[model samples]
Target: MTTQTDLIQYLLRLGDSALIQGQRLCQWCGRAPALEEELALMNVGLDLVGQARNWLDYAAELLDDGRDADHLAFRRDERAYRNLLLVEQPNGDYAVTMLKQFFYDAWHLEVLQGLSRSSDERIAGIAAKAVKEATYHLRRSGEWVERLGDGTEESHQRMLDAIPLLWRFTIELISGDDSETRLHAAGLVPDAAQIASAWQARVEQVFTRATLPLPAAPSYFYLDARRGLHSEHLGTLLAEMQFLPRAYPDATW
Candidate 1:
C-alpha cells in the first residue's frame, strides 16, 4: 500500500528537487553570459519554482501541516532537505551548469510524463501540469548542450569534462527502492526502470547531436536525500535563498 508517509515523502522529494535546482539556476539571474540567455534561464527557474510550490503545497496538505511552500522550501535545515546531490552541487561554469541542466531536465521530463498517468489523482494532476514546463526546459538545455559541444574546441573540452564530473549522480534518478516499490505497486507512481529507458534515449539523442562522447558510469554513491541527508552546498544555497524571508519572518509585501 502507498501509505500516507510514502506519499508525503515522494511529494517532498519532487518538491525538494525542483526547489533546489530552481534556486541554483536563479543564481544566474543577472550573471548569464548574454541577456537573452539570462532571460531564458530566469524563465526556466521560475517554472521550476512554480512546480515546486505545487508539489510542496500538496505535501503540506498530505501532512496536514500548516507549513506553506515558503516554509517548506526556506525554513528547513540542510539535512531536512530531500533534494538530490546533483541539484545542490555548485554551478561551476557555464558548461557545467548547462550539462547539469541537460541531465536533470531530460530525466525530469520523463518522470513528469510517467507521473501524469499515475493512479494517484493529486500526483497525476501535478505531473500533467509540470510535464509541459519540463518539456521546454529539456529543449532549451538540449539546444545549449549541442551548441557548446559542437562549438569551439575549448567549449567542447569543457563540456566533455562536465560529463564525467556529473554523470555519477545520474544513477539515483532512475533507481527505485522500497519507497518507489510501494508507490508503484499501489499505482501511486511509475516504475523507475521505465523512466530510465526514456531518460537514456533522450540523453543519448542530445549527446549525439552535441557531438559529445558520453562518460562511462562511475561508482555508485548512494546518498538518500529523501531521508534528509544532503550535499554541503545545500546549506549555503538555503541560506541565500531563504535570507530575505528569514530576515523578515512572515512579513508580507
Candidate 2:
C-alpha cells in the first residue's frame, strides 16, 4: 500500500526538481549566449517554477500539514530536498545547461505522460497539464542539443565535452527509489524501468542526429539511493534562493 507519506515524498521530489532547475535557469539572466536565447531560458525557467508550485501545492495537501508550496520551496533543510543530482549541477556553460535541460526535459515528458494517467485526480490533473509543458521543454532543449553538437568546431567540441560529464546524472533520473516503487505498484506513479527505456531511445535518437558520441555504461556516481543525498552544489543554491524567504518570513507583496 502506498501511504500518504510516500505520496507526499514523491510529490516533494517532483517539486524540488523543478524548483532547483528553475533557479539554475534563472541564473542565466542577462547571461545567456544571445538575447533570444536569454529570453528563451528565462521563459522556460519560469515555466518550471510554475510547475513546481503545482506539484508542491498538492504535496502540501497530502502532507496534511500547515506548510504551503512556498514553505516547501524555501524552508526545507538541504537534506530534506529530493531533487536529482543532475538538476542541481552547476550551469557551467551554455552547452552544459542545454544538455542538462535536454536530458531532464526528455525524461520529464515521459514521466508526466505516465502521471497523467494516475489514479489520483489531483496528481492526474497536474500531470496532464505538465505533460504539455514538458513536451515543449524537451523540444526546445533537444533543438539546442542538435544545434550545439552540429554547429561550429568550437561549439561542437564543447558539447562533446559536456556529454561525458552530464551522462552520469542521467542514470539517476530514470531510476527511482522505494517511495517511487511503492507508488508505482499502487498505480500512483510510472514504471521507472519502462520509462528508462523510452528515455534512452529518445536521448539516443537526438544524439544520433546530432552526430555526437553517445555516453556508455552504468554510472557509479549516480548513487543508488538519492532520497537523502545530494551534491555539494545544492546547499549553495538553496542559500541564495531561500535567502529572501528565510531572512524575511513575513514579507509579502
Which candidate comes out best when scored by TM-score? 2
Model 1 residue 33 lDDT score: 94
Q: List, residue by residue over 10-91, the lDDT tens digit for candidate 1.
A: 8888999998899889999889999998999888989999999999999888778778887898788888788877888888
Top candidate by lDDT = 2
Name every residue pair that clashes in candidate 1. none
Model 1, position 117, has a per-residue lDDT of 92
What digit string (tens of lDDT, one per residue) describes model 2 on residues 38-98? Answer: 8988888999999999999999877877999999999998989988788999999899999
Q: Which stretches of model 1 miss by more than 4 angstroms? A: none
Instruction: Give each model's whole-structure lDDT.
Output: 0.86, 0.88
Query: How many clashes (backbone N, Cα, C below 3 Å) per candidate?
Result: 0, 0
lDDT measured at residue 161 in model 1 versus the true structure, 0 to 100: 88
The Cα RMSD of model 2 versus the native structure comes to 1.4
